[model samples]
Target: MHYKQLSQQIFKKSSYLCVGLDSALDKIPSHLLKEKDPIFEFNKQIIDATIDFAVAYKPNIAFYEALGPSGWETLQKTIDYLPKDVFTIADAKRGDIGNTSQMYAKAFFESLNFDSVTVAPYMGSDSVKPFLTFEEKWVILLALTSNEGAQDFQFEELQNGKPLYEKVIEQSQNWGSHENMMYVIGATRNEQFAHIRQLIPKHFLLVPGVGAQGGSLKEISEIGLNKDGGLLVNSSRGIIYASSEKDFAKAAAQEARVLQEEMKVYLDQL
Candidate 1:
């Protein structure tokens, strides 16, 4: 889907929320284990509950990859079940050489039919350019992340006196425009959000680290939002696993609604 459509969804739903489908089998409710495909079963229910509030859904690739062939089948079923109007992201963090990157792009964009895929930029331009070739697909490049190890390399100052993560954003803008590219700016790094906003004001930011990760939604929403509502704040454990009981889907909806209501208030002020 195009960025224009995504922006419209945000305003239409009064939310910029992106529900992360890090649906690990071990973490899911015990009741779902009775189903032949527990992972897909859990994801279907979660999607049904959160669809109204979320503009996007990100399925963490690792969760599906771990189960091998059966896992891939389950992932496919979950993808097929999702509503086409909602944006889909393969949280794959995939990036390789140009030719290999092309294969990855095809696998996610053509085969699985995801709207976007998260990519790592350490391999540089040639590695990432292949993914940009697809029409209406997106490459969400990693910039500043929420993990604790992010302080190790992301903050290392470059010769230009800017941090490495900032340089990643600056150099990558030449690769793909605001239309086809986004930066993964961690909600945990909200202090740098204003500066990052100045760097790429119009590009959408796929923000993680809210809720379970302890990132303040209010501060990041204030710092990261552009006139187009350029943020897709993701919540994984906080929403999907809100309850361990049979009412998990209902609990997830409540969590998503709380965030959506807060987002509407913020958007109104914006």
Candidate 2:
């Protein structure tokens, strides 16, 4: 989907919630295991329950990749089942040389038809640029992440006195416009939002680390939002795995609604 359409969806629904479908087979309710293609069944129900409250859905690629070939089939089916208007992200942090990156882009954008894919920029411009070549598709480059190890590299200060992540943001901006590119700014790094906002005020940020990770929705929303509602705050285990029983879908929907209501408050103030 185009950035304009995504922005419209955010306001139209009064939400910027992006539900993460990190549906692990081991974590799903045992009852679903009786069904044919249990993984897809679980995802379908989750999408049905939360689609109204979410503007996007991110399927963590690792979850399906671990399941092997059948896992890939399940992932494809899940992608096909999603609503076209709701943005889709292949949460596959892929980055390689130019030739390989082009194949990754084609796999997600052309084959699976995801609206965007998460990418790592550690390899520099050539590794990220191939993903930007597709029309209306997005490359969500990882920036200041929520993980504890982020301090090992992303926070390292350079001789120029800026953190490595800040430089990643400054340099990667030239690879693609805000219309076709975004950065993965984890919600756990809420304190950095103010400075990051100044660096790229207009680009959308695919934020993780909310809910289960204990990142405050209020704190990130306060500093991370732009005039266009430039944030896609994602909740994975907190929403999808809210219950391990038959009420899983309903529980997921409830959690999503809570976030959506909170998002509406921020949107109204904006």
- Writing each residue's lDDT as its tens digit, candidate 1 over 205-255 gives 999999778899999998988888999999999999999999999999999
RMSD score of candidate 1 (Å): 0.7
For model 1, how many clashes? Answer: 0
Error of 1 at 85 (Å): 1.0
Task: Specify the poorest-scoring 10-residue window by lDDT in model 2.
Answer: 206-215
CA lDDT of 246 in candidate 2? 99
lDDT of every predicted structure (CA atoms): 0.94, 0.94
**Which tens-of-lDDT digit does each residue in 52-79 have in candidate 2?**
8999999999999999999999999999
Q: Which runs of model 1 end up more than 4 angstroms from their true locations?
A: none
RMSD of 2: 0.6
Cα deviation of 214 in candidate 1 (Å)? 1.5
